[model samples]
Target: MGNSSFFFFVFCFIFLLVLGTCDCLSDQEKDRIDQLPGQPSNVDFEQYSGYVTVNEEAGRALFYWLTESPANRDPKSRPLLLWLNGGPGCSSVAYGAAEEIGPLHINSDGRTLFSNPYSWNKLANLLFLESPAGVGYSYSNTTSDLYTFGDAKTAEDSYAFLVNWFERFPQYKHRDFYISGESYAGHYVPQLSQLIYERNKGVKNPVINFKGFMVGNAVTDDYNDYVGTFEYWWTHGLISDSTYKSLQKTCEGSSSEHPPVECIRALNTAEMEQGRIDPYSIYTRPCSYTTSLKRRGRYPWMRGAYDPCTENYSNQYFNLPEVQKAFHANITKLSYPWQTCSDIVGGYWTDSPLSMLPIYKELIAAGLRVWVFSGDTDSVVPLTATRYSIDALNLSTIANWYPWYDNGKVGGWSQIYDGLTFVTVTGAGHEVPLHRPRQAFILFRSFLENKAMERSSISI
Candidate 1:
């Protein structure tokens, strides 16, 4: 309300999580949630502050834990924000805690506190969850424990985690809640949200008050997100005119695999002319910092500013042994396949047209406020794709096109209408909090205050 403004606008893009240390569930329910046959005897929901194991119906056992919201230090006044990391294979605690939100930085020393200036949990209780299985410390007594790891399986496991988790923290049963995540979560966030909304469809889950939802640089639609990379490349000077045109022609199919035969040709042409060398070329450098690495010839009129934290954050956070040991030391890599996106499992679940827009529309119809946001410069799930995807619903537009500025520059853009508002965070990539903490904080403030921003697209 002071000098701050809300966003309403157009696009979406995305890119790429974490953890062990589960806790939260009643002793009786804990016994059931530990539906695992021989889960470690030491794994007690009550004895441990984290690492509470959740037993699934027929899938691998998963581990999840809740951290009280950073904002509600009073304990009596704080609300709960359950955080999920995508990658039907990733861990929320690792990404949400180590990278984006959550308190304490597991310093390079692996045992020191650098203190993250921007942990979203500060505003509300943050619950980090590691879903699916075969990823992180989550496991199962059965090797056939893997359930094809699709959207259905993720929602099922997540729902089970909630049931057990809520039983543990019975006091938070009526707390206000918001569902959030990144990357492949395009599939997870909505499925879980729908499940929550459905469970509360008639009488509501007494354990909590379901609020709206949030996704950052998420994959709402695979088609648009894929094509958007070409548009973003052209706009950002990363691809030449020839390359852009070639991509437009060749990479025109909906297949998540290689672009169609024509798409390959376009890529080859672009590579030949513009000098791009990667095979999976549609994906961008997780963010601007990485783009800076590919910095090329002079753009006399362009600024050379760069951000060092973009793509390297996971390496920074997970390298800490204390952080690693927190999850019982399973995280192995310093590089990537940082599976925060679609789980490299059996099938594509996010492939469903079932994004949150319809769900947001339903929530809005019920008089709830809804906000969608993105990070600019993220070609992975570009803003253009978000706009294209949302336009299909054709929801009534309210806060028409405008600029959301920051640092005296056009950080990005926005648009709004009815209760659904889409906003873009300037200088951000796939993960908004990780790339633009200040802006992300400003966003949370507006969201909590009920003043949503409108942007042109959600970026990754």
Candidate 2:
């Protein structure tokens, strides 16, 4: 058929190849945010938010918001970090994105957003996901699916979401990936990490490229948490000595998730003794607004900031029709407004292991980077609780306990275990970034670099 025919065939092949690539990218581009409705004008980074259907039969979809590092930072060169907030039913967009590590922070008016100087996106391409189909903007066509949500299914659906999400944002398919979260995500980050690690066992250079995970103020083992919590309350002078003794006697042997009547009574007594303080951030003033919603979960609600009313701002900001439109959320026009946590889902959580210590052992032995951090001021999952959980692991010490500094002041303390690293943010609360953004930023940078927190007083 000669030169003309061969050359024509080659041209057609190349044209189709280019066209197909463009077609694939167009799907991702559709989800891109040209600008958020109330986003700051000086912003010069790309952002995208949308839903990825995880289950077609049940019509379940999970929502995600990606905040890329500024162009000046060369976002393409950064690792991809996925952040989840655990209520077993919380919205990562509300907690992780709006307030904590994401680029935008909601204003008091709840309509406009301001730049977060210490947003995690500056260090990595940050992705916040709301999972389990009943939290925030994520939804299920089959209503019953919400009530049956549990650990195993949540992990499976999240894995599916990642698979489908990669198909849309193929550029990140092979990027270095890490999972992180706080509170109940103590279960999430590790469980998901285990699943990814197990699935990619024999495959070399898998698309997910999951390297490691980190959790802050996480719920680890029930037994350790109970012990540590009661101890913290007693030591901090929050609970009466009698209440502490009762808590130790009644709760040590009981399940933290489903306590017996005696344990519940003890907990109630402890609460009464502690009074009206914000248990999540013991030293901070509680939200004065009477209408502020408290999350009903196995664990207490984890919020960001010294101002306890931050969740109220998120509730107001995310419900705005224009904001939802910009986020490509609420397409189904749900019967309920957006909430920080879903009571139905959290209340109905079906299966949670008594301990995540075993998963930690497995992952650590498998050579994945495992880091655990605690915001010292968080009473919900306090530093004492984290310490107890890590002590249970009995991992060898790589670096002895040492104070880490930022800006010529003690930011926190650190200890490097043989297979895991542990950190404590000095005065941060349940959500470290909200309470201490600069120190949290440094902590994140150290986690990504797999280095110990700075021992020197010099600031980065």
Tens digit per residue, CA lDDT, model 1, 210-275:
787777667665556656656766786767887787777656454543336676666545545544
**Which residue segments of model 2 deviate by more than 4 Å?**
1-25, 289-307
List, residue by residue over 1-460, the lDDT tens digit for candidate 2.
Answer: 8899999999999999998887655768889987787888889889998999999999999999999989999998999999999877888998898889999999999999999999999999999999889999999999999899999999999999999999988889889999999988998899999999999999987999999999999989888988888898899998898899888888887766678788878877776787777777888888852343334422332222233677878989999999999999999999999988887888888888889999999999999999999999877788998999999999899899999988789999999999999999998998898999999999999999998999987665
Worst-scoring 10-residue span by lDDT in model 2: 297-306
Against the hidden true structure, what lDDT does model 2 obtain? 0.87
Q: Residue 366 of candidate 1: its Cα lDDT?
A: 72
Clashing residue pairs, backbone N/CA/C < 3 A, model 2: none
- Once all C-alphas are superposed, what RMSD does model 1 give against the true structure? 15.9
Error of 1 at 193 (Å): 0.6
- Which candidate ranks first by TM-score, i.e. highest? 2
Look at candidate 2 and tell me the lDDT of residue 129.
94
- Cα displacement (angstroms), candidate 1, residue 47, comes to 13
